[model samples]
Target: MSAPTISYENHRFPPQVIAHAVWLYFRFPLSLRLVEEMLLERGIVVSYETIRRWGRKFGAAYAKQLRRKRPSREDIWHLDEVVVSIGGRNHWLWRAVDKDGDVLDEIVQVRRDTKAAKRLLIRLLKKQGLAPKRIVTDKLRSYGAAKRDVMPAVEHRSHKGLNNRAENSLCRCENENE
Candidate 1:
């Protein structure tokens, strides 16, 4: 199914200006006021609350379009898991990244067993519509176990040093959350 078209009716600013403001706010880590200031520098006198409203109205559609524009799947995938504490409870964050260090998929689950790993693999494979030539991960036996059942023909490289890309991606995400 296709995404619904965004309506730009009943707005003072042109569609281009509104779209640019929304893009600036979501495509970067800048705050709403920062986005407002940047737009003001361009002589577009708009309120931060207006920008926030546009983001709330159009953010998901913009993100959906970006996801639809993903390039071809990489040949190698790096899979990793990390434990995170939330509300005094522990949850496992399973992530899959391509060779270029771009996150392909992620899932948060309570368990980090073979079943969880398999779920990640299945979701990745379904989303990508193709299995990578190989997958690298830490010395996690669950990954190996899941790989056998999900994509047995794909190569599995289990090494601590080989999966720094995935580890670093997780680190960056955690840092952003803090």
Candidate 2:
């Protein structure tokens, strides 16, 4: 498949500069102003606002293209979740991985519940385009509830011990600021 073209119409800076700025902003945890400062240090005078706009314009397409290039993934899925603090707020990150530890997909939310579990399942279904041959998750009731509703036909192995594959991948967050 041909790669999606990025449009650089009507921007004063060259396409490479705009693309690089957008890439820096999305490819790292740095804030928009930090991206601005980094570019300024490199002798580029673009504003943070411009970097933000570029990220908004091009980030999703770039991510989609990259995902498309990834090889087809394993059918056995191990799913797990952990609580993380981002910007002083608690968030639950649900992640899925194959047995070999390649990340399949992940989602973050404020609540860890049936709805959140279902959303993760739906997203996995949509993105991977195939139901897993088997899903292994911890003994969370929400996973059972979601699986019954979302993909009852697929085999589900729920065991706190069996899901170590997914759990080990989490690298649980520790609050270092304390």
Candidate 3:
């Protein structure tokens, strides 16, 4: 029996530089080719394809690591839904956030009914391992029913201007997607 050989090539620039180059590409609206040109100016010439690969590999890894390190604490969770278009079909983005504006969970669903709202809440609670003490939501009747079904003990607030935090978070996500 024979074993396959593994080889590693050391990069000319440090890992941090390569990681930063990829991070800047996604953190802004610039195209990959534009990022390549910017890196060229810094005396580190690399192709756009290479940068794309690095970003896909490292960006997701970094995000996952950062999420794992975050603390899970019980707090007020603001919940909201926004209309979105996916593949020419209307969808809704259900989002939950903490009082300090940290995202707890986000899910895309085909409807905004009670069942959908319940599913979103269950997913968020399961993933975060904590039920919100206070849930702030818009005046969506579905939210009232969902809260009653899934978390009857949790306080629910549904005032017109009170859910601005979650609404603003949805707007930020929408703007970034655009």
Candidate 4:
């Protein structure tokens, strides 16, 4: 499929410069002024306000293009669950990621049991439209039980070390809950 094109009509800067600014702003954890400084360092003069405008105008097109790519059936999914505290209560955040560490899906639920695991697996299957070649997770018995019910044919690997990809995909804020 062809990639979606972003229009840069009536802009003072070239398409490359504008695209770079927007990319820098979204691709990193940088503030708008930081992005402005980054552009200036590259000999491109642009205001942070202009950069913000370009992001607001063109960011959706970039995001849409990214969301168009689908997970492959050959992908090995790494699944992990973390406990997070919200409003003085504990919640489970189930997350799945491919070998490349791209998040496939995530859900926040009250329980971290077999039912929750099944829900995450079902969501992943429906969204990806295919079962992964294999699934890896920590030594969580819920994963094993859920996999048997949701996708009994796929290979399941349960090991703490093997699930680092999914573990790293979790945000630092969730880690702080421990």
Candidate 5:
């Protein structure tokens, strides 16, 4: 059979160039400017603004694609919340991750009460399509109500030091925001 036809008529650069540009933005926490500077040193002449746009357009898609191809979850789910400041207002960010540290979902809310916890659970349920076999959370009363309401049958456990995984995840986000 003849070789497959190649199509580079409309694009300015090859697929490998675009993929590398997108990979630099997603695989690291670096800003677009940093990525641009790194590429500039390597003789690439792309702009930071272009990199920013590529990230916004392709980051979520790439993340979703990678997640879909990953192995099945095998660890207990961990849930936690942290205080965040957005638009000069204090907010709470609730997050859930699988046992191997894959972020399932996150929600930013005004409070960490029962309603917020329930919303977080709902969001995760909608994304993951099933409740975790076991849920581990801190000794927050709101979590108790949320667990009962959203995942009645899942084992809910609260113990000191058991929620370190979730707490560390939140801590990482906090540090990145600073």
Candidate 6:
């Protein structure tokens, strides 16, 4: 089911300010203080705490709206993760792609363990409000472990090449960053 609408009727600030603050917070990795400063520079006086609240309150609504705009996704899902080196630290970027090559969801974490896999799966389930009929991943034991717990009824395939769609999409993102 689609998410119910959230009302912003009682807030003191104009809806525009609230929307802009939420946009700035999610559009970039800026901290709340930085977002507050940027809004102040634009002559909008809002506190960092207020921005944080707005993010906590409205982020889901925005995400829901965006998802509703997308075409309904296919039931077959491809999942993959790759190591990304930032400075001297290693992080695993996990992603899920549907049969049509659309990104269903993504997450970045330091560990590529069962917990991380479970988290990605849970988040994807929550965001899409639908579970895939099948999931394909590389031969990662973590994915198998997570799949059993999170989506026991769904089919899980562990193959080296089945998840190339997600990996290739991540490559395109990395290429743009470079």
Top model by lDDT, which number?
A: 1
Q: List ranges where model 4 is wrong by over 4 Å.
A: 1-16, 20-68, 171-178
**lDDT of model 5 at residue 174?**
68
Backbone clash pairs in model 2 (N, Cα, C under 3 Å; residues 3+ apart or in different chains), count? 0
Worst lDDT 10-window in candidate 6:
65-74
TM-score of each: 0.66, 0.57, 0.63, 0.66, 0.63, 0.59
The list of candidate 2 runs beyond 4 A from truth reads 1-74, 172-178
Go through the candidates in order and give the C-alpha RMSD of each one to the true structure. 7.7, 7.8, 9.3, 6.6, 8.1, 7.9
Report the error of model 5 at residue 29, Å.
19
Tens digit per residue, CA lDDT, model 3, 10-35: 65657867777867887789999999
Report the alpha-carbon TM-score of model 2 versus the true structure: 0.57
Query: How do the residues 72-160 of candidate 4 rate in per-residue lDDT, one tens digit apiece?
Result: 77889999998989999999989998898788898999999999999999999999999999999999999999999999999999998
Residue-level lDDT tens digits of model 5 in 19-132: 678898889888888889988998888898888766776666666556553333344788888888999999998889778676778888999899999988888877777677
Question: Which ten residues in a row are the worst by lDDT in model 3?
Answer: 1-10
Cα lDDT for residue 132, candidate 2: 76
Task: Report, for all candidates in order, the number of backbone clashes.
Answer: 0, 0, 0, 0, 0, 0
lDDT of 2 at 9: 84
* Residue 79, candidate 5: C-alpha displacement in angstroms: 0.8
Residue range 27-101, candidate 6, lDDT tens digits: 899999999999999998989999999999999888667653442435888899999897899999899888777
Better of 3 and 5 by lDDT: 3
lDDT of 2 by residue, 1-118 (tens): 7776988889899988887898888888999999999999999998888888889888888787766334343478899989989999999999998777778898999999999999
lDDT of 1: 0.92
Answer with 1 or 6, whichever has the higher lDDT: 1
Clashing pairs in 5: none
Candidates, ranked, TM-score:
4, 1, 3, 5, 6, 2
Residue pairs clashing in model 1 are none
lDDT of candidates 1 onward, in order? 0.92, 0.86, 0.83, 0.91, 0.79, 0.87
